[model samples]
Each structure stands twice: as structure tokens, then as C-alpha cells.
Target: MVYYVAHRLFSAHDRALGARVAEHLAAEAGADAVFLPFCDTDEEDLVADVKGLRLYQLDTRRLGGLTGMIALLHGPSLDDGVCMEVGYAAALGVPVTILTTDFQTYDRAGRVPAWQFPDPLIEAVAHTVVRGSTLGPRTAAANRFAAFADRNESQIDAAVCHGVDALLHAPAPVRPAPKEQRGVYIEASPYTPDSGLLAAARSSGRPAHVSRRFTAGDPLGAAVEDWNLAAASCALVADVSGPETPPGAAILIGAAAARRQRVIAYQPRPAYTHAPGREPNWRNLMIQYASDLHATTLSDVTAGLES
Candidate 1:
């Protein structure tokens, strides 16, 4: 059974999205998906008739039946209970897929994050992790659970499809990157441009791309954009600088680091910013993050990429 484990996205507040996602995944996954959308109540914590077990009994008894897990991550932080579920699923050798909305991107593609990195434990275990967004007319969470799914339906659908495919396939799940990736992928920011860095990346004689290039053909082709330059490249160059530090670059650093990818980081020097020490602690955090190949200059970064 494929366990659909989630928290804030479910609960009394956004249960509608929870139910809709549950049903949609069940339909998409056929008989392999097993979801329990039962809410905790004064009457009971929720008892599943399948094995006549209560919610608390999941870890002790039924968790052994888990083949895979799909986590819907959102809100301020991932809930403690859901984290426990992922842990249990992990102990049971159940592969996990994390679909998140909290890490919304600067670009509307929902392909990546603007900020808010996922848990390292999640990164290490989950077979796949996808960042998603509401994208269209933003809808406020209802006071009570609503009847329909929100504008995030398609994004949710895509995430579920990946999770199900991963679940059904087990050990060898489909990955974001191609088996034989081409060159280095350089990520850019919003307020500040990375054109200088882009040129530097290309000078290394490896294929490189910026966000503008990622969305060239289709204005909002984050999903339809077949090749994620980040995933396709041997390494990635992230310049986390400018007037206001872009959250996307920070979160991208985390994701890339989590994947154990060779990341070349180039940040504005301390003198470049008026606020002292390269945008305060943010740069330090990034330095510690991409310490793998933190470069002092664009030339140095390109040199590292070439080597």
C-alpha cells in the first residue's frame, strides 16, 4: 500500500484539497495507493477498518504494509506527525515523494523554490521531491473545507503522477536529471541579473542556461520545459546577490546541496553591499551551504567548472 502522509494540507482547514488530492491520486495510481483522510475527532483519532486499527496504531502495526509514501508539504513548517510518518515509512523501506508549496519560486513555474528549503532527512530518503505553487488566481484557504480543489490542481496532478510512478516502480524510480547530462546550469535571480556570470559559465566551454533561457519558448513553461538545466548539468553556478537577496537562489543551494551536486557559488563581496558582510548572515548561510566549491570571483567559478 502506498501511504499518503500529509498534515497542514489536510486537517480541518484544508481538508478539501487533501481529499481531492487523495481521490485524484487514488484514481491515477489504480490499486496501489492507500490513503486515509480520516480526521482526528473527540470521538476517536480515526480507526481504519482495513485491519481494525486506530491512527496511532499505524506505526506499530500497519506501517509494515507500506510500499511507498507521498508527502504533501506546505504551510509554515512540516508537521511533527507527518515527519514521524516519513520516518516510519523510511524504517519500513518505503520510498517517499515530497510535493511542496511553501517553497514558491520567483518564477511562476513552480519547478523550484524561492526560499524555504526541505528537511535534509526528506532529501536523503524521498525518491523524488517536487516544488509546486498555486500559480493561477490565488485562492484563500476557506474557513471551512471547500467542495473543490484549488487552482493548484494541475500542479498537484503532476506531482502525484511522479509519486505514483515512483511508488509503482519502487527501487528504480524516474529521476529529474537525464542519465547523460550535457553541461553546467547557471541559475539567475530576479532583482539582480546574472548575465555576467552566464558569460563566464559559457567561457568554460560547457553548456549553460539562465532562467530567461529556461522560459524562452513558453512564457510559463516551467513544467513543459522538458530539460531542467539544473538537473541536466554536471554542476550548477548560483550567484546569490543583488539589492535584495533572491530566496530562489538560497533554496536552490539547499536543493542542489542535498542532491550532493557539485555547486559553484559566487556571491557579492562584503564591499558590494551597504549592509555589511554580503547581505548579513544570508551570504554566510549560503557560503556554508555551497562550501563545496565557493568561489571568490566569476573567473574563479568558471575555472572550477572547467576543471
Candidate 2:
């Protein structure tokens, strides 16, 4: 009955307006909903908000600090907090309706490069693209998100358990150990320092090759294509240590793996690097993931493949 409105993190004025828009739309569609703006204020506020409705807050702005480096090493981005909120909502199957007319698309045409302007942010919204005249469909989609959320509480909790199990017993899957392929194409972010991981993977016997030298740039499109190539040829590895690897890549790989495909995760650490600083409040997501999957870290993955 209640829907969570996941809006872009912003100032009070904009957040209030976005809340009003979501409330209006949800009410018009006969669904009760509320907006939980992201903040770094205190745990009391977060605890209170999460208790009332779904929590729609960002994770961490910590990038290169200890925890941030850990996150990056594990596979998170600077914008991962927002992505985490969205992912958590989606995982809970929460009906997350994004209202964007509340803001305008700035033309940073000259100030910033054309490629950066409307791609990432625009694409995130595009996944749930709302048409101006299609309020009815948008409402329906919101309701669907709500229905998904209804089932999410239990499912998400169970997924946590699964991740933990995966990490503790990663080698239990019993799938035949993949042969040590000659050349494994690795697609990572331009800004990510994955040479260490690449070297680690190779040292373990999997020959790795990256698409480019490296720098921080968008690799969503490239990752998607590369994922498909890897899925088909069994010659690609989703080396997710790149800043450019879109959060959606995780979802895609999960989908592929669900279909009995062999998607290998070359995860090297326990944190998300893309996040900015070291915040104690930064959740230990990778550990939670390991717990949920019933396996230990991918450090066990190499042994599993060899076994």
C-alpha cells in the first residue's frame, strides 16, 4: 500500500517539491507513498525515517579513504550511495517512482564535455522513463514497484543470508571448474586501479586482458557488450573493479547467472572504491553480500575453479 519515492539527492527546496510531486502522483493513482530524502545528519534521523517508510538515502561519499578504497576494491562508485538506495528499493521490490519534471536538465554543453552531460543521470531515469502524457502508465509502474516492494522485505533479507552463505561456501556450487582459458578479456573502469587484481587473477592462472590502458570514464555500454561477449564465448570476465562499471551491470550479470550461465566474479576486496571517504556509517555491503550468497570472498573462487 505504501510506495517509496526515490528521488535524486538534493537540497531541501527541491526535495520538498519532489516529495509533493510523488505524493500527488501516488494519491492520484490511489496509492499511499512518501519520499525519504538522503542525508548525512545522524543515525537517529535515518533510523526514524526507515522505520516509517522505506529508506531512500545515499550510502557513502567516501571514495579513497580506507572504507572507500575497500568499497572500490569490492566494486562501488562515487555515486554508489544513490545507486544503493535504488538497488535496495528495487531489490525489496519497492515501487520507486522518480519524478524529474521537478528539475531541469542543465546544458553543461560548453562547461562540460558532450558525452558527460546527459548520459549517466539521464540513463538512470531512462530505465524508468516517464512520458509527459503518460501519467497513467507512470502511476501503474509506481504501483507495480510498490507490489514488488511488498514482497521485498522478506526477499531482500533472504538475499542477505544468501550472500553470506555464498562467501562462506563459495566453492560449493559444484559447477565444473572452467578450463584456464588462454586470453580472458577484462573490461574495467578507466579510473579504477585494477592492474593489481588483474595481476592477481593472472597469477592464479587466468590470463586477463583489458579493453584499454585505463582512466576514469563511463564503461556501462562497453561493460554490457563485453558481458554479452563473455557470456557467449566464455572468454570474458566481469572484472568489476572499474569506476565506470554501472551499477546496473551487477543486475545484468545476476540475471545471466540465474539462467544457468557461468558468470565469474573476480572480486578482490571487501569495499566499494567509488565511494569518497571513510565513514563508519558506510555499510559493510560486501560482507553482507558474502553472507547472503553462502560463500566466502572470491579468494575462494580461484580455488573453486581449480578444484
Among the numbered candidates, top TM-score falls to: 1
Kindly report which residue stretches of model 1 are placed more than 4 angstroms away from their true locations once superposed: 1-178, 213-219, 223-227, 242-247, 270-287
Q: Which stretches of model 2 miss by more than 4 angstroms? A: 1-4, 8-18, 33-78, 85-125, 128-187, 202-223, 226-279, 282-307
Worst 10 residues of 2 by lDDT: 64-73
Give the count of colliding residue pairs in each prediction.
2, 54
**Top of the candidates by lDDT:** 1
Expressed as tens digits, the lDDT of each residue in 23-128 for candidate 1 is 6567766534556534322113333442222334433344446656666666544443454455445434467776675544333346754333322334544567
lDDT of 2 by residue, 268-288 (tens): 543332222223211223212
Q: What is the lDDT of residue 205 in candidate 1?
A: 88
Global Cα RMSD, each model: 13.2, 15.2
| Residue 155 CA displacement from its true place in model 1, Å | 22
